[model samples]
Target: MINTYPLLRPLLFSMDPEAAHDFSFAQLDRLERCGLLSRFIDKPLIKPVHVCGIAFRNPVGLAAGLDKDGKHIDALATLGFGFLEIGTVTPKAQSGNPKPRMFRLPEANALINRMGFNNDGVDACVERVRRSRFYQEGGVIGLNIGKNASTTLEDANQDYVMCMKAVYPVASYITANISSPNTKNLRDLQGETLLRQLLSALHQARIALSDQYGVRKPLFLKIAPDLQANDFKFIADLLLEFEIDAVIATNTTISRVDVATLPHGNEAGGLSGSPVLNSSNQAIHHLFQSLQNRVPIIGVGGIQSGNDVRQKIDAGASLVQLYTGLIYKGPQLIRDCVRVFN
Candidate 1:
């Protein structure tokens, strides 16, 4: 396999961050369609592990945000992730925050994005997932759902319930994402009172959906990296109490301590990459201690190498995810992570 991203990095880096993102996925899709990608990349090696009752081919997955609407499942699958999580799709599609929403801090090997969960609505995302080869192959596909930016906080659960019902029949797992820092007041859902209410509604809905579809899908919660120890303890207890299947220990951090001096370090959005490695690991360790193995953890943030993935596993993650790493290191990072298990 040609694993050299160095030859291609400068061209991609020259474009605007969001433009580069779109161009890459589009090209990947084209390569996949033309049957050219397979010639350069083999299927990832098997390193099977079970988390949240789903059997994953490996412990490395492509995280949410990168493919927000589930539009690139087949193309992304070509790169060999054990699984792919798509969306933060909302009940209704709303254009996210204004332009210039994504920024790269190459100096810090990081990115800051406040995409605001902009997507083509839950129905559109569901249709794309249903049409994907990845979904048809019975590959593990996690659909990450969120409330609309326009939805009032008081009525957020409705959006979640609606999306859960729509995706339940097609998803290997469902992620209720309340952690993205870009959304106005979205993190408020992480509070004990609101989170309990949201989880209870979704739990009941999941049971009903399982009975109806004759299939049960695991549910996960994606949370932020910024939280006090007490807050994490409370959230962990809530997960056990609600019987939520797993937790993706962190979306992105609003903190910029590590990259504060770098260009775009002060950008208004969540910071992700090497800067978040320690905080994400700390969150996983804390959640593991609090959950006591009753719930699984999908650790992400600042994962750029096999060692970074291993550190997450050592902390308490049953599986790990990548986003910024892939941007910084290319598809080779996925193989690097899987090789760690080998």
Candidate 2:
């Protein structure tokens, strides 16, 4: 089928970034319900990959945030992703940062958003996943969890533990999201002492949850790209020490070096898309060097094409994910990246 996103792009681009996001998903859900979505998008290419003990139909998976609440899994699943990760969910629901928080930079193929961890909360997300056909059909799903905005830094571990227990049963894997710049002082968790404390708590929680559910779900950590050079090795060492299953290298960046001159360039929040590709790759490369293939790396941040996917793999990513790229390149990008693996 010929790609129609190019034709539809102009229309979506005409609306506010957040509104366009909602409108697109609303329309996607409608198309899916009417059984018309398949006609417009091709099935994802099959290139099986086994990572962290999970069998993925393809390495091209949807990153978290796009379906933060897990409400669009079935519709998104139809687009042919090998897997889908939902959430950055907290223990309680939140309205997130104020409106006009998300922005698009077409010239740089980038997006700046301070959406925060806005969602229906972990319990609601869990219930939605339980009701989704995709989950029932055994689709691989990763649930990314985080702390509530009101939670104190000292009490953050409790929030993460709460979310982990809530999602453990339904998650093929669980990611501890400590990287979003939108969340006030969230990145502080990435520091050595706090990260160790957080990981230790999560490790113990996973053990209990595994025994309770009779399944040992893998735990992945999502980190930021704005870290000091030595931080990568430090983080890698901690990953090894805690037996964390995998690491998602470099979440949205706080740096504006690349898109600093473009519109919305100075927007505070994570900067993702083409502008983030290089730094993300650098982070992946650093992690790979420190990890020495001991822990798998899921590369994400600005991947926009098949070659971009290859860059991640070549840099030592066992798997890769997409979010901002989807906004710029559409569903065809998934097929394009999957074909590369084949």
Candidate 3:
């Protein structure tokens, strides 16, 4: 599989980034459906570990935004992730930003995406998860929830609450995605007062959903990598105050300093891949220091190699996730990370 990716790379690179993304997933799904995925994809063989009370086969897992609707879980599951997270699924379906929203910087091994939470809505996503053989086979699935673009900041809680309830019954964990830079004012939810309000609402909703379903689902907050010292401290404190299960320290960064001179570096969206590693590690280091082991951190952003994955763990990430790295390095990256734990 690793050897083949080098050959497949040119064809994928020639296509529009988003189109390539969709086509690749479709082909993976077809291969999986035909039972040929296992012939090429290596299954991860790391010792299982627990994070946020859920068991994971390995620490390497897929990040959200790649499979926005939970439609490709079964196929993606074949790629050897310890756990699979899908969506940034909004309460309702949305078309998301505009065309040419996802760009590739081959030289830097990076991507700039402002593809705002485009999906087939929470209900549709929930249905897809419910029907997934991988999900039913006990694959750990985390549902990442976000508010629709049309939903105002003031009403964000309702959107999260609605999506939470719908996904709670099926998800191993739920992520509040208030950190994506693409959504208008979405990052503002990270402000002290609003974050407390939003988390309080989500906490109450989680309790209700737990009672109704007889299963307690863990809740994680996905935050931006561009936070300052004060902002990071405040968020760590809020996570403790609200009893949030964990924090995915560092979503894509709004900073373009590292890639400013590269093509599409100045694009108005979150920058991900190699350039984001430093900022993400800094945020993880801050959160790990501030929370002082009270809250666990899932490190994401710019992880492209096993050394990069190890650096994140050494920086205090309990578990790590990858998106852009997978695109650049291919499925063997998962094997490489799993080997780190071994």
Candidate 4:
């Protein structure tokens, strides 16, 4: 696989990032269709991830961006992720921001994407999830839902609430994505007043939905990696206020502030890869420190190797996720990290 990745990577790299993703998944789909996925790729890819009231088979999860609409869940699962998170889905399907949207920073082993929240919508993702052979049958699948970019901050609660209400039935847990910097004014919703209101509304919706579904699935909030201590404090307080089940320490960082020496460091979009590793780790430590272990965390960003995975676990993350790391390290990284977890 290592020998083949170099050959395959460059071919996919030549295409646009978003297109490359579609192409790769399409290949996975075809491989699944051919029944060759498990025969070749599935050699003990999952361990077990017990966090936030969900039992994921492993700590290595495919981060949200790679399969945003849950379109390739089963195919992706066959590659051996212990868990999968689909969507940054909005209440409504959206085209998101325009293109040359996803940028690659090869030197830094990172990706900068302003793909916004392009998805087939929460209801659509839910329908796909419902039919899915993974999440539907109790394999671990988390849904990360976000507000439609056009929604106002004041009305954002309605969008989030709508998404939670729609996807709640199909998710092991629901993630609220308020951090992606690409969405205009979306991060503004993370401020004290707006953040609190949104959480309050989401929690109320969660309770009503849990009553409706007769199951208790956790509700987690995914936050930005680029924030000051005070910002983390306020957000942490809000998590406590809402009694949110867990906190995903980061989505991605907009601060090119950290990787000044890397090529394309000035790129406009959130940066996720090696450069933001420390930032996300520190954020995780802060959350653990601030919450006093009151909440479990799913660490993301710059996770490229088994050591990185162990660092996140040692830093108090119950589970860790990756996107750029998988891009840089290939599929063996997942198996390797699971070995470390064992």
Off by over 4 Å in 3: none
Q: How do the residues 180-229 of candidate 1 rate in per-residue lDDT, one tens digit apiece?
A: 99989999999999999999999999989989999888999999999888
Query: Candidates' TM-scores?
Result: 0.98, 0.99, 0.98, 0.96
Off by over 4 Å in 1: none
Whole-model lDDT per candidate: 0.92, 0.93, 0.91, 0.84
The alpha-carbon lDDT assigned to residue 225 of candidate 4 equals: 84
> Each candidate: how many clashes?
0, 0, 0, 2
**Local error of candidate 4 at 310, Å?**
1.8
Backbone clashes (count) for model 4: 2
Model 4 spans > 4 angstroms off: 1-3, 258-263
Q: Which ten contiguous residues of candidate 2 have the minimum total lDDT?
A: 37-46
| Candidate 2 TM-score over all chains jointly | 0.99
Q: Give the CA lDDT, 0 to 100, for residue 332 in model 3.
A: 85
lDDT of 2: 0.93
Instruction: Give the per-residue lDDT of model 2 (tens digit) for 1-342.
Output: 888899999999999999999999999999998999888888767788899999998998999999999989889999989999999899999989998899999999999999989999999999999999889998899999999999999999999999999998899999999999989999999999999999999999998988988889999999998888899988999999999999998799988898888889999988999989989999999999999999999999889999999999998898889999999899999998998885
- Candidate 4 has a TM-score of 0.96
Candidate 4 accuracy as lDDT: 0.84
Candidate No. with top lDDT: 2
